[model samples]
Target: MARETWGTRIGFILAAVGSAIGLGNIWRFPFQVSQEGGAAFMVMYLAFIILIGFPAMLAEFVVGRKTELNTVGAIRDFAGGYWQYLGGLFVFIGFVILSYYSVIGGWVLRYILGSVTGGYAATESAAAYFGMVATGTDTLIAHAVFMLLVIGIVALGIQQGIELGVKVMVPAILAIFGILAVYAFTLPGAGEAYAYYLSPDIGYIMQNWQSLVPAAAGQGFFTLSLGMGVMITYASYLGDDKNLGIDGISIVVLNTSVSILTGLVVFPILFSAGVDPATSGPGAIFVSIAEAVLDLPFGRVVGLLFFLTVAIAALSSAISLIEVVVSYAIDEFGMDRVKATVIAGVAIFILGVPVTMNTVFINLYDILAAQILLVLGGVLLMVLVSWLHAGEAIEELEQGIGDLGSIGSLWIWMVRVPVILVLLVSLYLGVTGYIDFLTGAFAEYLGTL
Candidate 1:
């Protein structure tokens, strides 16, 4: 069977953007901004996305379009002997990420139902309501349902399944987000929320660079869907003569736009309700928004739209993560697409059991996959593409756009020196910071008990 290619250029772009915009942007970004000095985190995140994230994205595109293969095949074919193991690590990263990611996908699904029925609206405390539903039986059922949805889509192959799905999903996501943003801006505290989200605190960043930089860097990688084979796998479906650079910039811009838009929707609501944004972590969206919406006009209708948008966004991204590993199975082993998808989905669902059973495992897997492993993957892949296969990478990059000249040299330089150095530093800080974070969290939990 011939390898599946994207049906159209726009299809590919939407799908790639869909992959980049996910729960990381919608759920995690707001909390991260609140915790990491608000606008200081925003500044650093945008810098990393433009400076480090773009070049790394192009590098992944080069490898994928050059080989027209999954990450494992791309690395193995380009750099023979022992290098394929590196490719396997990326696939593993995707699997691990999706394992926990689907659990959150489950949460989004539950919230969607909660929005429809006003189930959470009757609760005295949104935090307590979230605590009740975030784990155990309800979450396990939600996780299974979400994982099954992902499997059904991927099993249909690229053009029919992933491409067709994202084409509809991405647009709906953008439209709903736009509606929500406009409504949020009309809130009384919108100006204050904007100041909190957009105003920079340089001193806070300087004082807390150790934790902030790594967290921002990790958020950059996580939100952009970098440091995993998702981009590589998405690009593998591309036809020739496509400009990887321009497409990459488009993805980055759209992804960042949505991240900012999510803040527009979230922060205004929180500030208007006089809720503290920093107090909520993973459940920030649920608790803060749930509480805020109860006091707003047509709050249930707005809540439904918001959670509906989140559901679509989560599905779009989950499709890409599963595709990374499913493509590997089909490409390397010549397994049938449907079979590969089912097997991959089942394995990921099983892996997600612990995450659904205990919410603590959610933080554990998130830090392990998003913060630590992702930055580590970025470091290794950057070195592999920019250093090990410099000539081939440049040649592939220059295909759609003629003769990069100074541009090509600069990209390699960015990837080699600063990108690698920054990721390595982030990885180190992430490891130590996560340790302290975990320790403190544990002691705090014990004290409460």
Candidate 2:
């Protein structure tokens, strides 16, 4: 059997953009901006994206295109020996991410259904409605439905399945969100909301630079879908003719644009309805946005569109997460694509069961995958490229990017030193934060006992 290559360059670019633009952009990025001094955080984040994110992305691309294999096989072929296990770890991180990620996808699906049925409109408290839906039988049914959708698409094989799916999904997501952004501008407090979102608070940033920098760096990596083998797997299908540097920039730009657009839609609606963005927390979308929609003309229709946007974004990303593992199974074990996708999907769905049943386990898994494992995976990948295979890595990069010049030397040095240092700091912060959370939770449990 021959390995699959993407049918067109546009197909490959859209698929990568689809993977990058997801729940992280819509749900996580806006909240981070709100908490991290708005425009100041945005500035720092863009800097990291250029300096750290792009180089790290290119390194993954080099590994994938050079070897033309899935994460484990790519490392095994490129470096051989014990280093291959590191690639295996990257694949496992993707699996863990998809496990909890699908659960959230289920929540988004339920919201779309509720929007159509006026379930959220009838509720006296949107928060209470979310609480009921987030666990138990409702969650399980939604999770199953979401995972089946992912499996069906992936089972169709690469160009027919993943490529075709994102081609439709990416355009629809943009059109829908574009409509929402235009609608948000007509709301009563649009100007104020824009100012609040776009204005820089130099004082706050100066005071909080220590915490804000790491948060921005981590968010930059997470938003691009790096460190979890998604990019590596996607790039493995590419031909040597493609310019990886150009495609990488395009992915980052599209992903960042969507993130900003989400804030345009979210903050304006919240302000027009007199909801305080600060107090909304993670409930900003479910509670605040849901309630705000009910008071507007044609609210149900708009609510339906909003949740539909979320559903599309979540699905686009979920496909990539599942693909990382599926590709690995096909390459490493020579499993058939359909069989690999089904087995992987079912296993991931089963893994999500405990998360859906208990919120504590969900939080723990989220911290491990997002904060800890992702940073560790990224750090190891950079080390492999910079230390173990610098000569080969540079050669691979040059195949797509052409001449090195001074820029190439700068790229190599940045990845080897500054990028690795930033990731190490992120790993330390993630570990300490997780430890503190666990210690506090354990203390509470002991008191109850």
Candidate 3:
């Protein structure tokens, strides 16, 4: 059987951008910036996206185009030794992400229901409702339902299903998010939200440079879907019909715009409503933001739109994640996409139970999976492309890159040695103390009352 290619280059770009623009960009990005250093945090995050995220993206393109296999097979065929370990790392990271991501996807479904049902009218009532959703079996059922939707789509195969799915959802997501952002701009205290968001605290970041490094890098990596097999898989479907260089920049721009707009909608509402944006840990994005939205005029209707858009973004991204693991199964085990999808989805569903049942565990899983693995993945990708396969990879990357020589030896080498070690050490600290610091604060907040 031959591998599937995307129907159109535009369809492929939209799907790739959809995969990149997930709830992490919306909820996670804003909250992380607020916690790290606000405007200063945004500066670092943007910098990393350009430096690390863009190159890693081209590297994945090199691997996918060269091997025409999924992550597992790519590494196995390419390195022929420990290279397959890289692919295994890809599979592992995707599986871990799916476990918790679908749980949040469920929350999106619940909020979708609320939009129609007026789920949150009064500020106080909205807070209580959020608590119920966060700590309820309701979330479990929603997670299962969302996972099923993802599996059903992947079961339809890549061209007939995944590409078509993103083509529809990505546009709707943008439309709805645009409407919500317009509405947000009209709200009382929206200006304060803008002020709170735009005002960069350089002093805070300078004093806390240690914490900002990994926080900004990890968030940047996850936001662009770099340092993951998603980019590799998306690139594997690419044809030479379009300029890879131009399309790569477009995807990054679209993803970054949605993330920035998400902040526009969220932080303003939080500042106006007096809810601490950082109060809920990683979960804070949903819980705290929902609480703030409940206080706006016709707040329930707004909450409905917010969560519904969130659900769409989450589901779209979740599909790519499941595909990453399932593609490995199909590529290596000869399992059909349907069986592969079911096997991976069901397995992750069971593993996700811990995160679902225990809110604390769910938060911990979100932090560690993203903070440690994401940065680690990005660093390794930089080393591999910038050095391990530099001579060959750069050639492939530069085919349409215009001038390959401009990247310079020192420039590429920078990502290979110092940059790699820095991200690795950041990963180590993020997995240990930082987890305790962030989660512990979150747990303390949850424990109150």
Q: Pick the candidate with the highest TM-score.
A: 1
**Residue 353 C-alpha lDDT in model 1:** 94
What's the lDDT for all of these models? 0.89, 0.85, 0.77
Residue 356, candidate 1: alpha-carbon lDDT: 83
lDDT of each residue in 74-192, candidate 2, tens digit only:
98998898989888888888788788878888888888888989888777778877877778898999999999999999899889998999999999989998999999999998999
Which residues of candidate 1, in runs, are more than 4 Å off? 441-449
Off by over 4 Å in 2: 280-283, 446-449
Model 2 score (lDDT): 0.85
Candidate 3 to truth, TM = 0.92
- What tens-digit string does per-residue lDDT give for candidate 3 at 1-449? 88888888888788888888887787678778778767778777777777666656766777776677898887676567776787888888888888888887887787777667666443356557667666557778888998999999889988888988999889988998899889879877788777667777788778876778778778877877766688887777776545666787888889988988888888777877887765646567767766776667777777878887888888788888888898889888999888899999999888887777777776566666677877777776677777777787766665555565766455467667766776786688677755676877778888995
Whole-model lDDT, candidate 1? 0.89
Ten contiguous residues minimizing lDDT sum, candidate 3: 118-127
What is the C-alpha RMSD, rounded to one decimal, of candidate 1?
A: 1.4
**Residue-wise C-alpha lDDT for candidate 1, range 1-449, written one tens digit per residue:** 89999999988999989988988898789889988888888999999899989998998898889888998998888787888887898899888889988998888888888888888887778887788778989999999999999999999988899999999998899999999999999999999999989998889878988878898899999988888888888888887799999899899999999999999999998899898988746777788888888888888998899888888888998999999999999999999999999999999999999988877887888888888999988898899998999988999999888999999999999999999999999999999988987999889899999
Lowest lDDT block of 10, candidate 1: 277-286
Cα misplacement distance, residue 162 of candidate 2 (Å) = 0.6
Q: Indicate which candidate wins on lDDT.
A: 1
